[model samples]
Target: MKNIKLTIEYDGRRYLGWQRLGSSDKTIQGKIESVLFQMTGEKIEIIGSGRTDAGTHARGQVANFKTESELSPLEMLNFLNRYLPNDIVIKDVTEMSERFHARYNASGKQYSYYVWNDVIPTAFYRHHSFYVPQELNLEKMEKAAEKLLGTHDFIGFSALKKTKKSTVRKIEEIRIEKNGAMLHFTFIGNGFLHKMIRILTGTLLEIGMGKLDINIIDEVLANKIRQDAGETVPAAGLFLDEVFYE
Candidate 1:
């Protein structure tokens, strides 16, 4: 058997999420598994680097699966693309070392949230970006974002449920860039918790709108309470930008 790694990109508007939840739910993993099962007539499990919430999209999501098929990388890519739905595309496929697990081996991940700031929402960006009518103070947003860098317990930004692991994570970078009516916030972190990015985005939006004091970021981080944070933004604006591995 060989371990095959796939680099996938998808528009998550039509899918439940990345993972398969139920027999009836249409998901990225479910669609890929269905295609693999049809092509090989074998039950195969694909492991994703991470999960994206419903309506979230991805540009460089990585996944891996084990198979005994002797097909070459290009051939497998073509075969999977032919069977997979149009929303999900297998951008590349390659054979990897047997011990390379997609999730565990990932070094870090990058996510970006897009916002359309204009008087009227654009029909073309309806599904891709969050439309906000109020003008955002980018300077204030950047100031608040800087505080989020480095290692910290992100309990306030995460789901209010206990997990087996620690909520402490290191954010390597946070960048805010705007062009025209498009505003993008990119975050690179060692790892993330459920809805962490969206919550962070919402909090920053509050700062931008002058609803929340930029200095309140310190209190939110110190409080470590879910309610202390801002609202969780819609998943439509979030995208799994990239996954990195060594």
Candidate 2:
């Protein structure tokens, strides 16, 4: 048997997220696994680095699966791209050691969120980015985002109801950039809790609009209050940019 690693890119607008649901074909994992089964004649299960919420896109998602098939990695890649939906694409495939597990081996991840910060919404990026008609104070948003960097218990920023695991995750960087009417936010972290990025974006936007105070970031972090954080923004604006492995 051989372990195969796959680099994938997908537009997740129509899928039900990454996990394979029982008897549900409307998922990214299910769609890929189904193709794998067809190619290998086995119920091959691909393990993703992490899950992306519905309507969340991925520019460079990583996954791995062990298979008994004799086909070459390039052959497997070709077969997958040929049959999978147009919205999903297999970018690369390579053979890996049996010890290589996509999730466990991942060291860090990079995510990007896009926002349209103008009154007029464009038909092109309507589905790709979040729109905030009110002008945002970019300077304040940047100042507020700086507080989110470094290690902290991010439970207040996450949507997970209960998790026994530690919420003390480190955010290496949070960059907010403006390109015309578009605002691009990039986050690099060791790991992200459920809905953490969306919540962070919402909070920053609120601060930018003067709906929340810059000092509130310190309050939320210190208090660990979920309700104190801003709303969870739409998933459409989020993207899994890349997964890092060491």
RMSD of 2: 0.7
Model 1 lDDT tens row, 107-187: 999999999999988899889889888988999999999999999989889875877788999999999999899999999
Clashes of each: 0, 0
The digit string of per-residue lDDT tens for model 2 on 1-246 reads: 899999999999999999988999999999999999999999988999999988899999999999989999889989999999999999999999989999999999999999998989978998889999998899999999999999999998999777789999999999999999999999999999999999999999999999999988998899889899898999999999999999
Residue pairs with backbone overlap in model 2: none
> Model 1: what TM-score?
0.98
lDDT of 1: 0.92
Off by over 4 Å in 1: none
Top of the candidates by TM-score: 2
Model 1, residue pairs in steric clash: none
